[model samples]
Target: MAIVRFVLCLMVEILVLPVTILQYVGIWDSLYKRVFPHLMCRMTTTINDKMGKVKKELFDKLPEFASSSGLTILEVGCGSGANFQFYPWDCKVICTDPNPNFQRLLESSGAKNEHVKLEKFLVASGEDLSPVASASVDAVVCTLVLCTAENVDAVLKEILRVLKPGGAFFFIEHVAADKMTWLHFIQHVIQPAWRYFGDGCYLTRDTRASLEKANFSQLNVKNIVAPLTSLIKYQIVGYAVK
Candidate 1:
């Protein structure tokens, strides 16, 4: 069944590849942001609420594994700057996203200025990050991001590279459903259409496997269900020291 789903996903990606390439390069940032986030919000809110709860747990749990004191933190795909308020007073958090409008919003929030030169802001993608320094960050945070990434493994290696030895990576992500037979079937069947609108989100990816395969030690994952679908599965909140 897993092989069948992977094959189906690959077929859809092949079909969508050309248009996706064009959209990635030709779509203007302003236009993309206007349509993209609004379209996704309505479809994604229920899962996002679950995401928020898991992120809150990470904020509280991070101090134990990746303390804020003298730490440099990085947030990938930081939409709306939602995680900013939860950060500790002493940490320097670098918020990054490829979306230009969202980057501008983060800049205007004064998260950049108030932290002075300490805080870094950049327009970067998870799979290809340029602003982050190797082995320099104390913690890397990603929430509900992998579903949209074109290459999840590359991003994980990037996360590992940027994290200092003994530093931790914190995350909360939605994964493939293990409980909802009907909804899962629908998700699998309509994935091609979903890919077009979702900008590449694959609900079928076993996010836990991807994370663990990245060599993140001490793997711990738990299933979590949101308001609508079991495919909104798992809220994973364990740290792997680099």
Candidate 2:
């Protein structure tokens, strides 16, 4: 029995679980449309762990980025509005995604901000966000959201275009598999299937270089090498001042 349970956990950890692991960890808008299997709602019913809360712990490390209030903010690739609760209350947040069902679910979740319902839940792509004005947004937060966005460069350009001159861009992304032998091997082997079923999420991408090349300067980056969570180990969590 113990061995069976261990095997079950291993299976879940191998990137195929009842729940789309990308949705739970990546929290990107496109996961529902691109990555998730039908009947994936069954997994959400069992999720007790809060990825957003765990992610919020790294926020205090970003005192400068947190000081803004009432600034217009955009959470590009906002998936299911899970990261919505972690952002500051005063800043107006606009969450965009391509999935209408997830958008309606987010709407029905009654996800509200202090000032208003997080404004403008739109059916949009990150590469081309037309509704938002350039140089008008004060901050952009991308949390584990880069891997699946159709064109990362276009999205980065959009981020640069929208951000105000001293605005902050905070992100927590799951990058490519690290140099570790076992994980890298698995990641390489699963890359094809992951692309097909995991919503175009690559197990490999230098997430930091994307931010750096966009003319944004990195503020902090932590490489978490914790066990059992090695798949997300190559993490880059920090804010860049534009």
Which one is best on TM-score? Answer: 1
User: In model 2, what lDDT does residue 103 have?
Assistant: 66
Alpha-carbon runs more than 4 Å astray in model 1 = 1-30, 37-52, 65-69, 108-118, 228-235
User: How far is 141's C-alpha from truth in model 2 (Å)?
Assistant: 1.3
Best by lDDT: 1
Q: Cα lDDT for residue 15, model 2?
A: 52
TM-scores for all predictions: 0.76, 0.73
RMSD of 2: 8.0
Segments in model 2 whose C-alpha atoms lie over 4 Å from true places: 1-54, 60-69, 110-116, 226-229
RMSD of each: 4.6, 8.0
Candidate 1, residues 44-87, lDDT tens digits: the string is 45544646666566676655554445767788887655566556
* 172-234 per-residue lDDT for model 2 (tens digits): 788776556667666665665566555567877777777767767545566654222556556
Each model's total of backbone clashes: 0, 0
User: What is candidate 1's local distance difference test score?
Assistant: 0.69
